[model samples]
Target: MKEKLSRKLAQNVEALKDIFQDSSDLVYRDIQFTESRRGLIVYVEGIINVDLVDQNIISPLIEGLVKAEKPVERLSELPFTRISLTQTSTASDWPGVIEAILTAHVVIFMDDSDEVLTFDVKGGSRRSVQEPSTETVIRGPREGFTESLRINTALLRFKLKTEKLKMKPLIVGKITKTDVVVSYIDGLAKQDLVDSVLDRLKQIDMDGILESGYVEEWIEDNPYSPFPQMQYSERPDTIAAQLLEGKVAIFVDGTPFVLVAPVTLWQLLQSSEDYYERYFVTNFIRWIRLFFLLVALMLPGLYIAVTTYHQDMLPSSLILSIATAREAIPFPAIIEALIMEVSFEALQEAGIRLPKTIGQAVSILGALVIGQAAVQAGIVSAPIVIVVSMTGIASFTLPRFNLATTVRMLRFLIMILAALFGLFGIVVGTVWILVHLTQLKSFGVPYLLGVSPYRLRDFKDIFVRVPMWKMSQRPNSSSETNRNRIGAPKLRGRADEHEGW
Candidate 1:
């Protein structure tokens, strides 16, 4: 059952006051066009554009600009141009009126009328577009997504100007009524993948959604998995690139981090700078990233296993020096490594939470001070300190924060395994991780998409990136149809090709 609006303006005002009892921010302004006709304008203070409402809606009505044959038609015959508004319509139900006021829409009540007119005036202060701090690139667009959903979608539209680029909207929370957009290219994206994401979004029923992480947790395929199933970024250029590769982006209101789906382990490791720079430069950097990725995940564990189980593997001089350093130490190799790792993790977390001006200096000075003091006191060996420092540096090289956290967590488990069974335990952990990765799927797509499946086409961008001229086709990340991106690719341009276009 629904309550209908009354024709009497006085009764309607009373009803509205009752509906919004004890709310001091709710405003109700009385308007008198002439002697017999009366009206009421309703809105929430501060959220809407007061000037626009006054200049466009209220000013025209109070003045003699509007013309109507009868009192009933006077409310509908306002002569003014609408700016940044949706289709104006008459709403008759109390529920619609309440919803309109809550969403920054202005409602008008007229005497001797069965309905009222509502106008969309959603506006407020929001952060402007700026450089993304999380995924910074040496070369790329500096503009990033804002907290506004419409503004975020508009940013994407500015990058990709095509009718085929569709952004379908969904309201997730019942109470908050947060807006969400699912953006994708029609031909490039698989229809099934879009439907899969939409279905998951539709099934979400919650009281409120404050951030994109809420939606992410509810919709991800494996909630218990340590690795993030979807990649989130604040850079519009990143989201645009992902869409061009046929991935769907989820844009949540009040959040700048838009999430991209069907991501892989390699994708998390690769930075946006890779695509911006030359093939040779990016390829070398990616190789370095991979090398450090391995070091970050296993350096401490390997050191512990070697010292505890197989000291003969190291050179005579290195083994003798390490043994001399550890002679005065009280803790075992594993304990020493664990202590250093925990201290480093705490410093890293504290540095992030502290103010920016002193955070970096604090982290650096704290690590140096603590490491030197511990070494001098014989609380830990010097070799383990170097190993932990290198591991921390390596973890920072990873592009994705979530993936780096995963590596940090796995490092401890690997250290425990090494302590128990030496190198064999590390090998067992490696095998277990590989099996789990092969089995993990992101929205029905394999976590190790091209690596496990061995796609020859994806290798161009995976291990080593070929020249852009050779990359005429899209990677294995997208659908099979329309795989080719460019018509032809040439290795070199002729000397005569230097003429201006």
Candidate 2:
């Protein structure tokens, strides 16, 4: 329980001093409203707007009281218009007052009154909007989410202007007391999914929620699963698009990455640029990415398996070339593949860890110089180097970093299985992965949505990027009630006729 503000000024001052004893940033000032009426103002030094507090709060109260023919009985009862700031509210207890002050609001205390007035002067330094570093696109909105939570929400609001869009505020951490916002279209989002997400968040009683990833780990359907059940993006257009499809977006203060839940594998693979560009171009790109996705996951393991246990599968010319390359090398196919894969992964990590200029140089040279040296020294075969380099390049095409990382990890695991049982091992591992995916759920939606327990309608935007004219319904993974996103006919108009607005 918190102590209530006293009717006496000196007592309240002593209590405030005890509470903010060692805090040097707390600013407390006493002002005389009239010859008889006294008051105090409290705020933090850097956070609160000093000029606004002075002009709207202090100057008006002192000047208005002096100009009045009769003195006011209490500060709260003051009849002057500019005496206190607009959007001002009263706090009767110390906790409320302190909370207001901590959140960058200015608090005014009257000597004879038991209530304190809090003015919303939350002006401090913050980052301006800039282009996203992670999720880049050529033809969509260039603006991205900043570290500021309010700015991020403002970016979303700028894209979507509708009363149906609702943001429910939540406080997650006990010590950090970080602000979290759950945003979704009120009618489109399923009530049960929203309720489950809120309940999971409320149950998180921890010291801190430093990043949105923290909440993500806790609320995700399967913590141990390598697959990313929830998708995170720094683009407002992405988040806005998800909200329109009835997905809930979770925004954590101090992190630019926002978490979008009830995500499917198809959603993870798709990019915002797909919707922004021409349909044919996007479709072609999607096919290319899909092909590379397979190469990233299966290329290394398949090479090892076929060369080791099923060499007859390859053509005679290719076999002769692979045999000639391995003639000088001592290591088997599995060991050769493992050596190249590990070296490539190390170079990738080094590139990310080093400084920007040097990192790029190192990642490029590290692969070229190291691979060439290894091949010439006969420590590894040339074919293995080519396979590993192609696998690395293919992994880069994945849109989401988390998904790409998952592919890298699973690639190694499948490689090991292939080393043990050859072609059978690859089949076994693939079956196990498929079984796990079929069993997995993100929130309540299936992980392999549109493919497993398949929804045919949801495939409009999946592997093949269908034209927007044909995509009239929202994704089924959202469990949306009103699914008709576009109301007109599938075809826009005839080739020769231009439809008039």
Q: Model 2: clashing residue pairs?
A: none
lDDT score, residue 495, model 1?
68
Candidate 2 residues lying further than 4 Å off, grouped into runs, are 65-72, 78-80, 83-86, 496-501
Q: For model 1, what is the C-alpha lDDT against the true structure?
A: 0.88
What is the TM-score of each predicted model, taking all chains together? 0.95, 0.93
CA RMSD for every model? Answer: 2.4, 2.6
What are the per-residue Cα lDDT tens digits for candidate 2 across 320-371? 9999999989998888998899899999999999999899899999999999
On the 0 to 100 scale, the lDDT of residue 190 in model 1 is 86
Model 2 TM-score is: 0.93
For candidate 1, the TM-score is 0.95
lDDT of each: 0.88, 0.88
Candidate 1 stretches greater than 4 Å from native? 64-74, 81-84, 489-501
Residue 471 Cα positional deviation in candidate 2, in Å, after optimal superposition: 1.2
